[model samples]
Target: MPLPTADTPWPPVDTRVLTSLADWDAWYSAEPERLEQRYEGRGSLEQANRPAQYAGGLRGRLARWFWGQPTPAGEKSSKLHIPLAGDIARTSSGLLFSEPPALISEHQGTQDRLDAMAKSLHPTLLEAGEVCAALGGAYFRVVWDDEVSDRPWIDTVAADRAVPEFRYGRLTAVTFWTVLDSGDTNDRRLFRHLERHEKGRIFHGLYEGSLTALGAARPLADHPDTAPLAAMVDAEGGLDTGAPAHLTASYMPNVRPARAWRHIPSAAYWGQSDFQGIEGLMDALDEAWTSWMRDLQDGRSRIIVGDHLLQSLGPGKGVRWEDRRVYTGLNMLPRAGDPDPITSVQFAIRVKEHADTCAALTEQAARQAGYSASTFGEHGDGQAVTATEIKARERRSLATRARKALYADPALSDILAAQLAVEAGFRFGVTGLDLSVPPKVEFQDSVTEGLGELATTAELLRRAEAASTETLVRMQHPDWDDQQVTAEVAAILGESGRAVSDPTMTGAEGPGTHGSGPVE
Candidate 1:
């Protein structure tokens, strides 16, 4: 076959950035780079045409969307990133957040991808493992799965590029790759070999990595938990065939209200690559993101409202966040009187003007926020609106939108999945991922009355029995102990025996963190 040419199209990218409204228009108008050669689809499909297949919250919706789609074998598939048309609103404060090239989907070439793409969401899916690249290690893939993935992402065969005139819109794109069991799609793997050239350029002004303990090492694309990333890495057992490497990135959802953020980005980072080693990748990202944030903050502090698009120098300066919406969706409800939901500390950078504006609007919204109580209109004292009232209004807005958005679509079974993903991002440290079907969180809680917390059921009892044995041995030998020597020794031996037999570890500090199945 022809050696992969340097002139080949770059690999898939999911980076989301904000360009000036004018610039964004320009980019859209710009000529297509390589598509003229192969894909010549008429711009008929658009995000609007596609149903918002996610709803039960982002996470569960992902699983539903994925499980619902039929994955062709041997490749990893994923939604590059999602774009909400709403963010581009004319809030007059926050600038637009855009993932140029709009939403995207891609496939990774790895063994994990091959296995993940071939199964149904079921109990045995977790123990799934595969070793493809058949004998002679030429062209073959094998997969053995034990657990079903909770969330899955599907991509349409071709994307609809032409969008209507800027009426303000959101876009979410996905990546789909061929899989081992997916006989027909196998031929698509060749397309992945063509995407390597389009990786995002490093921005010395923005840094996503740090030596700090909590810093992010990879972008959302490289995250291990992402089903798409796993499948991609395991494509055709690429590793077995010694394929060039790729990595996944981690993208934490910035659900925090845009107001609380010390800084906000005009756009969010969608995904990244795993090539060139973690350290090198980190090195390239660190300085750039850091500086970009700083600059945005520097410029945001001074907002001369009226009629203008926002801009920023970076972080750590004058940003009018009061006017920005912040991620109002992420605000937390801390207590009864406190205003504003406890938003996430992770902030992105936008402009100083945007910051101040966000801050002001948040305060206005908070002050105007309604609440509930025995009484409704008790005039006089300026004791801000009742929490119940505010919630009522918010709920109304949400309900109205839900009626229209896919959030309430009964047709798709992803509502639960989407809700889970959104919950995980907020509750757990997890972002949107193709979570495996919970596999039944069957908790054999110690409440099994007869078990008596004495090491509880099998696992815990075994541990307690073992500990008792040591105490008994010490007692049996007076010189080494306390209580009745011989009798205690007998009891200790008995407990020890039971421990060996049952082998329980109830109430032990905690069990292993790895999954029940062996590591691949």
Candidate 2:
């Protein structure tokens, strides 16, 4: 959704539903401190003078593992082992795991209390509904492969060796939402909630192209283990009926792509995939997403839990037969990412300092784990390892070793600068084209000692059309702040030369100057 811009403004947010700008702003503003912390912290340093520091604290979720290993026999399942509190009071076969099942221990009292059981089970059913609701759809990756990946093509080979075809995919989110509307309650069921519109949406997403008739599809037993749990309830008992029905729903897929295409134009910008792959990647993005939607709608209802009354109680008439039990399980997802703002900034910034060669490899690892076109990311999204683990994953080579050996030398930053400059020019299509910059004859300032005025790297190249006397001197510094960024950008604009320096980094380079530099 294209949200409203701050200046354009919007109306007050609806407290009932997220309907206005203030609500959205409240949602978005919770994290602005991350940015402010980044800007305020850290000073100037040589971009190429130091070894890459380990991502100390602020790496968010890593991707997840998605082998895409095929579903088998047209029947797929993921196990969830739930923790339990106690044994049931009874046991039976083909049990419904019915709503309002008795929780009173046989150890306490085996007789009467049918009304109490109903009252107690009513809340238990309600609690189960609440727990399901708390599953909270926050993170799940599904996407189409980007057409521009260095690797070409992916075959979604099913367990039966069926090859589904497609190409483009980027990361996408998977979300769930429940629907509520008036529905006639089943005499057996005490509660109900379903609206025509919500059902239509679910049906449309699921049965769009399926050949099988919905009626003919077999409903899966809620849980096989629950069948043996029916012994606790009295065969003919229980009273009271008013209760709200509970159901689960999925909202929308949250596609946190490697980059925000609209906010970001170039690959060098962090928060997106660096310059990799081609333009056609967006094409394959749809199928993977819609297919999953289809699966969710068609298969979900069949597996949902619902209670069916085998027999009913006559008005004011009851007996001493117990009839309910519960034998199922549930699971929850843990949180991921760094808690502090400074750490996140550093993690992303460091990725850039390395020119992103390593981050790419990490992404490559994600892909191999089953994130092709139709998936957002695999691995890491849920994994929250410390900086130690991240740094351990960095790429190493003999050149890195030599570079490390000369860490203290001034020439070292120069060498690192050369390498980064080459990468920046090569990947971002930004060469050190010069503009009419002041001659680098002097470099004395609070920001930097003995640096001169700055100009676009492009302007410096046109010696005939512009200031030709502007000389460029190269100097390396580390830091990502106002003064440091200003100077680095000045250097970057004058980067066409072997050594470019401008201590007064006041001039923000037009366009391509990301100022993610020591001199920006």
Candidate 3:
């Protein structure tokens, strides 16, 4: 598909897609105001008019405490928001990228290139992972600027900013856009820069538009953002990538089968968000925290006294409570059955109940978001545990990590291949590098077992005579390549004086010989 031109609808997304994206983005933002605004925007007149009906429901109750209207006293309600949504996104990213994946290729030159690229791009990939978790998915586009840098780099486009075209569940093309400038007062023009990726080409279009319409196509130079690209584009306003379409850009879903929008064909390709199906739980958590804080605030000790107990200040000034060693007797006497003039009172704060509620809500939210409570520090008895034990406790989190990696691996590999393809096509930094084979992205296990445990396991296997030297070596050093394992095995055999001569060769002795001597 080509880029949008004049008369095209702006953003090019249906209402469902817009709503889904907006909801996910709002939750991921972790801002109370944004959440409240989102709720208000989606709320109905009926919900607004009938406070009792609205506040009776779970979501309504949460809203009432968290981001609803001010309290009855006319003071703004104080709400404490626990940013578990943001934490989940960050944890998702950290699980996948805490230990950088190895981008390996059979070709040495390609390997070197990938290594260098990974070194420079690790942080970007980590950020992309977090965005993917939060936004359902992210687009990886191969971009370059000779003026900025010699080598082309992979750029991440948030899911909201992209209009992707998919065929048979595969990403065929994508149009990435940004609002470059929204013109000042009278004009009220919205200038948008759109870059559409297709087979062997990238189309760049600058549109002078309103919020809802692609008004007219403008020259790329008209906008500062697309001016540099203007010089690089061909006469048709497209840059020739000289590579396969899919190589230029790829869409990485956070998880498979966007369950929330699965019924909508247009949104089927979209990824599942980490915050999906847990918004209410998250809201309830924030509400619980806020209520707890309000308790603390309202529970403070207070003294009730008659106006006579207050000291009078100057004419216009208000009376103040003065802390004095002794108080003078008032002219008026108290009634026989009346209570004392002053009394101190403090409401009991429900500390345990609130803490338990918050903990339960947090655990439920984490679990609903496909993570273990332990992952979010909701474990019982805060004590250190072995890596194996931690893994056992965080199995759900590990499983979630594995699921995300499945979606990330291919997208990462494709973009990396695209990076190499562009590098080779433009002959940027490295030349003659083989692009025949795409790099493999091997994610390291996020949970690392203790070295002692690993050694013990290897020893047990060796004692059982159930594994070979190669297997033991691999168990000890899982990250080592075949060549490294082979070299290490040879060295170990040589040191142990157990090296056997090859019988196939012209040797003076048989297979049992060691250093040309026959075995006793």
Name the candidate that leads on TM-score.
3
Task: Name the lDDT of candidate 3.
Answer: 0.82
- In model 3, the runs with Cα more than 4 Å from the true position are 42-74, 182-187, 314-318, 324-335, 426-430, 468-471, 479-520
Give the distance in Å from residue 480's predicted Cα in candidate 1 to where it truly belongs.
Answer: 56
TM-scores for candidates 1 onward, in order: 0.18, 0.14, 0.87
lDDT of each candidate versus the true structure = 0.25, 0.23, 0.82
lDDT of 2 by residue, 178-204 (tens): 121213343221111111111101111
| Candidate 2 Cα errors over 4 Å, as ranges | 1-282, 300-377, 381-388, 391-520
Query: What would the per-residue lDDT of candidate 1 be over residues 1-520, giving only the tens digit for each residue?
Result: 1112233222122122111221222212222221111111112222211233333677435333211232245644321211111111111001111101111112222223323533422211111100000000001111212254333222111111111111111222122222122134533221121111011110101112211111222222332233343343332222221111211111111111222221323222111111101212222222233345556555453434321122454686543434565634543445565443323333446555544543343333222211111112222256555444444534433232222222112111232233233334422334434434311111111111222222233344445664444443442242442445545555545554532322243235444322221111
Per-prediction RMSD in angstroms? 26.4, 33.9, 4.4
What's the true lDDT of residue 217 in model 2? 14
